[model samples]
Target: MSGAVSWIYLDVGLDTCTQGHDCQHICINNGSSYICKCQGGYVLNADQKTCSRSDACTQGHECQHVCLKNGDSYYCMCHEGYVLNADQNTCSRSNTCAQGHDCQHICVKNGDSHLCTCHDGYVLNGDQKMCSRKNLNLTLTFEMHVVVLIHVLMVMIASICVNSDKSYICMCRVGYVLNPDKKTCSRKKPRSSDTCAQGHDCQHICVSTDDSFVCKCRMGYVLNADQKTCSRKNSDLYKRHDVFATVF
Candidate 1:
């Protein structure tokens, strides 16, 4: 029996070992040979049939903050108050107010931007970059003597201050022209040919004057409530039509 060939072995004709035998991850079959492969986040063990944990934070990893090992790969993640940068390999401050904030009073940090806020007794202006006085109503809550004293003090502080029914008017700078409303500067002298060039909203004609312009309508039309637009007169429109009435 020692020199004799063993005929007790039977061939099943199926290559199960070469197909997927003992592969913990993937099995690659090459004819009568086979190779085992591990999925992402796993490495082929020394036995070549099982898989082991792959260190995601090892060399060749490019995570910004934390490198999390998933089922078959790894992902980059950021920590609190930080976000992955554009390159995805570094972290930067997520607050938007970290950069150049132009807020006049307060700069509230947001997720990726900032908000402007005014302090007490101040309100944000139309431009939102500056603050203005909060109590613009001009109603006097103090005694008459106090009001008079305040007005006197304000006038004393400003040499060119002038009070009017509507509002206070300030003196214009040299070579600058005051507007018709008498509150703000309109333009400079050596004016252009057209005085209404900037804010003339006339629907028909704008007549230039010494310092400003007057809005005028055509011959057949009259000025509307806006004083800059023209409308057909009711008298002229009704004159062309005959009126009739019926009593029920």
Candidate 2:
């Protein structure tokens, strides 16, 4: 009988707050009794009726990254290589390559910057982010001889060579420059950029010149019309001196 009375006293304390009472906050029915409660960041006044702002963060928050606390105030922060989410509590991986980049082919991270590259059948465009199909025109392998002649004729119109003291000095017209052979001419190359100056796009070998660059193919292969690509050299065709016909 005494134990039952003790249990009743423990379950219901004072038991004064009710629906009709002026709590100025929430009313909680704690078993048979009631208590006045305030929302988050609020504290109940000494009168047990009024509530005031506590200017504080609730204890034991679930911040995904790190929880920052300053006296009674608190916030959340993310670690490196992560970003804070919209809820200001959770975090996400730093999506610089997928969400923040404009690369149309491949995006690779290099130190603090990102590098964009294209696939095998594609070449990087002027923007360096987008890719374009390589200009390997549809033609039979035997027909490259004719294509070579066309490329030579295009070079002929650009510059001319003059004989001086048994040697030759190429006199290039505007926007043209002497080729690696120093006898023919090719179009003036693009301005060497800091990005491109660091490397070349050749598949086999990259050769640097005075004012430009050149791509070379290894043995058993020949440089293609695109000057960067390569194709197998026809040894039988090279043996036939009549294979090449000079273009006028």
Candidate 3:
């Protein structure tokens, strides 16, 4: 017989197909070789055997705020009260009122965003943002009305001024002119004293001239339209006034 001629054949390719083989993600067998692949949000690493996050924000890939990956795509996001800028990666402030800022009179920038504020004689409402008249329920007695009328009459007779808060002051006291403070009276210069010494209430700079003093602002500030106050030149100084009314 030919028993001594019998031989055996081995399938080497099947021996190499061991589930995922040595791949970090998925491995496909091709009889004689294999290949590695990754799932969504990941890509084959440099070694071609492992996977890495595809949305990594490093080097050329960057995000102004945050970057996220989902199924081969990525997106940029910004903090509250901000919206994606024209660049798509950066952010900018959104409309104050649209973002829930309840400003009754004006909305001014606080930092990257804005805040609600009210004009003089107004107070923040229960919402803590909207503004409302503080003394809405105010009532005057007969005697108080009489007194107010008398003060008004005096103001008219003396050529003085009276504010809504019942504040009264002489616009031009005898021999004196209205000072930069508006509440105080200043004497014309060329006299024995210097009116600039009265603290013109000029927030930034004050310069004395021949007869009176001029109110000036610092380098980065501008003289308010009133020509007596100072405000930041880069800020919206002309916006609605947002200070409490006080008696002069």
Candidate 4:
């Protein structure tokens, strides 16, 4: 009806309301344009609208030829001839050579390796790589003559000491008597008590050589060659006395 009618108007901007919404979380608004944020451990693409995963490690920086991978990083290592450093970006030399002339065994050194060997009559212990003398046997013996000589000397010394210590009592074997000097024993003394009567009785005498003895009568007493007893030699005076007594 052409007769004055009222028209109702709705404003889109005023009516549009975002409640409990977050930028770069749920969505990002830019002049009627929107974008979504990437998750953790990821980055947005160059378009800034789409999300793409980030590559922190690229090119050779990612890992070495010989390396292990972890959550977000890697480690570098080398072979026998090379050694890796703390940074994991470089390598260095290893000490495998012997020091000075102290090394006796043959030594071989690689970039990061070492070995040792011993010369003749020697041996080397592991890890230490040092040489040492080999074990050997020792022999010893004693000659029979030497042993006999030592025994004889000891016996002589013992006898001298015993003789010097005891003065009154002398060492004498059976069938023997101590000489006047008290240093030796003579076997000339007879078993009869009459021969040894006064300590110094001279009934018999002995001649000693080496380790043997011989008995003989005193000068005045003649030994009846039979060794029975001492008797006076045949005398002319004794015979005449016998004749005179008979005549009487």
Highest-scoring model, TM-score: 3
Candidate ranking (lDDT, best to worst): 2, 1, 3, 4
lDDT (10s digit) by residue, model 2, range 32-122? 6567888777789998878987744455776887887755677889988777999989998766685477899789876445789988767
In model 2, the runs with Cα more than 4 Å from the true position are 1-42, 45-49, 52-56, 65-92, 109-113, 133-248
**Residue 7, model 1: Cα distance from true site in angstroms:** 23
Which lDDT tens digits does candidate 3 get at residues 1-248? 85677577657657444744777888887766788888876779889889987755542345588776544566788887788887878888776656666566888767666777788667777775787765522544454455457457656332344435533343654766776665444555455256688668777777887657888998868799888898776544334233222322
lDDT of 1 by residue, 123-219 (tens): 7888877887654345333442353464476553322444444334456556555666543444365867778776787899999888788889988
Candidate 3 RMSD to the correct structure? 25.6
Q: Best-fitting candidate, measured by lDDT?
A: 2
Model 4, range 126-184, lDDT digits (tens) per residue? 55578775542211113323333533765533112121221223355456565676544
Candidate 1 clashes between residue pairs 3 or more apart in a chain or in different chains: 40-72
**Per-prediction count of colliding residue pairs?**
1, 0, 0, 0
Error of model 3, residue 178, in angstroms:
20
Clashing pairs in 2: none
Alpha-carbon lDDT, every model = 0.69, 0.70, 0.65, 0.52
- Report residue 122 deviation for candidate 2 (angstroms): 3.9
TM-score of each: 0.32, 0.28, 0.35, 0.27
Q: Judged by lDDT against the true structure, how good is candidate 1? A: 0.69
